[model samples]
Target: MNWPQSFIKPKYLSLTYLLSLFLTLFFLSCEINYDGDERLLVTGRILNENNLPIPNQDVEFWIYKGSGAGGDDDLISLTATDNNGQFLMLIPSPNNEDGFELKISDPDTIYQHKILHRILDKNFTNYEYNIGDIVLYQHHVITNAYITFNKTTVNTSLMDVKFKGDADYLVWINEPETYYGDYEPTLAHDYYKNVPLNSTLTITYTIRDNSTETLSTHEATVTINNENLEYIINY
Candidate 1:
């Protein structure tokens, strides 16, 4: 039985190898389950058309439970942007078949609301997702018009102005709502208002002469486009 030491199986070495294999299997099982209380962090920024940060803006996050349009939405969190237009929040990781959405609104009525959607699978582990900058556009058009009278009189004044446009167009006259004083007759008046972008706008101007009791009106039609923010009208 004492042939040589090399022919003998070391019991200590065999036990050490079995213990290492058991530890490896245990760690692998823990990773599969991922049974931890860790959360996912998300951060982003909001900006306007001028590439400026929009501070004190509200942002919302929602999670989709089911599939397709019939899915139920679960509100996760709501936060506001800081002075620098930065936002950060933490939410639980969605299930393997779930999705998420983010929404931001323009409360000042200067820009349009933004909504983004994403589907996060199981591959997305505990990590911080930075969405960078989200830019919004101006919802309405700021149109300005300048007026000139064909014949200037001592009692000439701007009476009023009216605007008409296509079915989807909305117009509001902002300046010269009332008649100007005869002593303060001016050659120009600015008509500034917000209207829908990319539409046809028809402007009508009214001029009055107190002494002669004469009322004059003029009409002009112009197509409002993104490039034409401000417009000029002659009467």
Candidate 2:
């Protein structure tokens, strides 16, 4: 049984050609991406100061290009938290020199806005990033006031308090009308009352010594809105 060399060579060459074609197609399939850039997954939860989940809040992702003089932010994705205060977002792969910023805000005006600057570094390609829990503080119209006295103070009792604003505007204080200090001035007093949003609040207080002598008089003004406010008075 003798086979011709010419026939064997043709069959071997044909098999080699078919094998090369199959390998080329397999590699091409592996490298092709039909959906464009690779996607990066991000997950997080939103909570309030009370440690309760905040649902239905808007979460935003911003991508920036360049730096300093020519940098600009581009809104990439917008998503909302679920009932459990959880959110997931898919971000496309960024360039080697791009930056990322994340922001979340309550739509019901109950919590203050929160912003996380530069959460993602540059050249963060297709990868998952977990931000865990982000807590927002409650918005308050009133500010808490703490008053302290220096070692040279004689009297430590508030005698008179005055509010200068519209006559129709009502000023309220959660603490006692008059605060009397013993050895140390009360530093944890909540005297400032909440005012209507977007209003100007001015408070004046007179403190006297134990012998009925006026120790000091002080005044402070703040523009009240949806942000947290705290005032400290050192006599």
Candidate 3:
């Protein structure tokens, strides 16, 4: 008598599961890396509050537990970022996976940790997915930090500014329309979060001098401490 093709014996399934467990442990012990274009490749960049790369930080990938059928939350792989604060996770996509999570953490109390939840729209699109940029805020806080851009020349056309992270009325990438020249403290665009404390914010702005009819490029830096420190930009 022969069994059905799709029918898996309970004992056989247990053995296969055990074997996979052994393999996962062995691979992790040897090298926290897996390679191949066919595998599911997840990548991201890790940065500090000041928008600086964080190297050698711990990163992990976990698959959620499937309902009634699959096992518990499966930790597929573990790895760390390179000198450039970049990480790559290559693993075989499991069967019937609802979603997954990418966890970034530090064992040493240097930087605060983060967990990113990703839900698949039916399934993944490409072999590679990039999570653009991630900022891990270090342990600290700035009670009152602000920025004031003063117009040096009269009749200035427009002003634009950028920061290493979010602010009251500023987004790291683009300027919010509601924020004319003042920020009330909020968040937006490209991984928005509360202002990072005790960090140096780099500001690059383009101010058009109407009288000169030329664009001026300027750079400035301001360090935020316990007091009300303002990043004054004279454009």
What value of lDDT does candidate 2 attain over all alpha carbons?
A: 0.61
Give a tens-digit lDDT track for model 2, residues 1-235: 7789877677547877889888877554333122346787778898765679999999998776555544555687899999999999996765542456777878897776666655544224347887788766566533333333333453466545555541121212122223332223434334444444565777777666767654677786866655545655554
For residues 166-211, could you state the per-residue lDDT of candidate 1 as single tens digits? 3211211122223341223555555544444576678777767777
CA-lDDT, candidates in order? 0.61, 0.61, 0.62
Say which candidate scores most in lDDT. 3
The residue-by-residue lDDT of candidate 3 on 1-235, one tens digit each, is 7887657466556778889988887554443233343478788899875689999989998776443432456789899999999999888766545567778888786777777765452335676667678877665553345566655556564445555544332212223235543321222112123455665667666667666778777777766655566455554
Q: After best superposition, candidate 1 residue 146: deviation in angstroms? A: 31
Q: What is residue 128's positional error in candidate 3, in angstroms?
A: 1.7
Candidate 3 regions with alpha-carbon error over 4 angstroms: 1-38, 66-71, 121-123, 142-195, 198-235
**How do all the candidates rank in terms of TM-score, highest first?**
3, 2, 1
Worst 10 residues of 3 by lDDT: 183-192
Clashing pairs in 1: none
